[model samples]
Target: MDTLSSTVQAWAGSAFAAVFRGIKVVRPQRPIHPKGIQLVGTMQRDDGERQPSGIPWLDTAGTNRVEARLSRSLGLPDAFPDILGLAVRFTEQDRLSDMLLATTGPTGIGRFVLRLRRDAAAAVFSSMMPYKSDTGPVLIAARTIESPGKLPVDPAAFRSLLGGESWTLELHHATPLGAWTRFGTLTLKLAKHAEDTAERFDPVLNPLPTAGTYGWTKRLREPSYAVARGRG
Candidate 1:
């Protein structure tokens, strides 16, 4: 996007951020996705030799401890459909990093569509926004691959499942209009005292290694992230 457009978006986003900050002030909790469960996992990143994502982290093969959180966007009742989110944090090249994903379509035009599902494990989780890479731009995506059954939306039930069973997800990278290419695998289980985990994931502030920030996409997000982090 052009600088002028980014500036305009920044202004509008800041206004929205102010409004959200006020809500958080009143409730003193997450501005969105207030209910969630923490997960601990291992991320096995594979170098995509065939379709390199142009991001060093994904292009380099390695394994890292991963921390993740799953939540309902609206904190809706367990039986109802609501947008779902997956927030992942890890270390890359010794620096803390994060990737925040939400339910979205998996292909072509659908990739732009935000989807809602009652079962968190059944929906595709996407970056929702693309990252500027050396190869141009790319989106990261994940979907449960070897789940035992449909995972409920309730944080309580979800935590129970996480305790006894391991959940696996295939990680992929794709251009906005291109096909997805596998780059990693994530296996998650419940962490000790996960219910008390209060870690925050912020891609805008703690972006993935070797990914471009301060670009058009980040401009659209910085305001809200700043406000949410109590920095604005």
Candidate 2:
């Protein structure tokens, strides 16, 4: 029985990895901080099912906050089939801007969403869906920023507070009925955070080729125009 269990575990792990194989982030856009970006959006799946949900990674506690509307008619390029749509917001406070990143998970496969917000002010929050399986606890690791008093805010400081160049969002799942478990790790980078600049704010989605892949090395690198132009 022990040997049988071990073999099953190994197979389950391999199967999980295989499902996530060759998943490359072909398009990575810069983070967009629109003045009135919407927080709630309707996600329309390829199967013609529309589900209303808050942007997974963003906070939507306010009543007057902006809302997002998504549809297949938006027509993302083929390279970004996994990402449905994104909505972001930036608030102008005093002389600084607070950034928020919100995105929906791939349609129809799994119901998942995420949001990230940052500002010179001291506050942060990250939440995920509550589901249980036989494996273990599924977890999403996130970071928050807070300063007791007024602090000099710099671009690098903001980026570092957001997890520097090597930050990532992890989706951890424990073993269910099988001997093995399943999980996914998505590496994220503060690709670009422009403030009071002439350049238009663009959000990039660079999916890693495989789970557990790192994006620190590429975060500082210039974003590929292929993604930017494709959306255009």
TM-score of each: 0.92, 0.21
Give the TM-score comparing model 1 with the true structure, all chains together.
0.92
Best by lDDT: 1
**Per-residue alpha-carbon lDDT of candidate 2 for residues 40-128, written as tens digits (9 for 90 to 100):** 21211122222212222211122112122111112233222222222222322222212212233222222244322232232211112
Model 1 clashing-pair count = 0
Residue 104, model 1: Cα distance from true site in angstroms: 0.3
Residue 107 C-alpha lDDT in model 1: 90
Itemize residue pairs with steric clashes in candidate 1.
none
Question: For model 1, what is the error of residue 96's alpha carbon versus the real structure, in angstroms, after optimal superposition?
Answer: 0.4
The prediction achieving the highest TM-score against the true structure is: 1
Clashes of each: 0, 21
Which parts of model 2 have CA positions greater than 4 angstroms off? 1-83, 94-222, 225-232
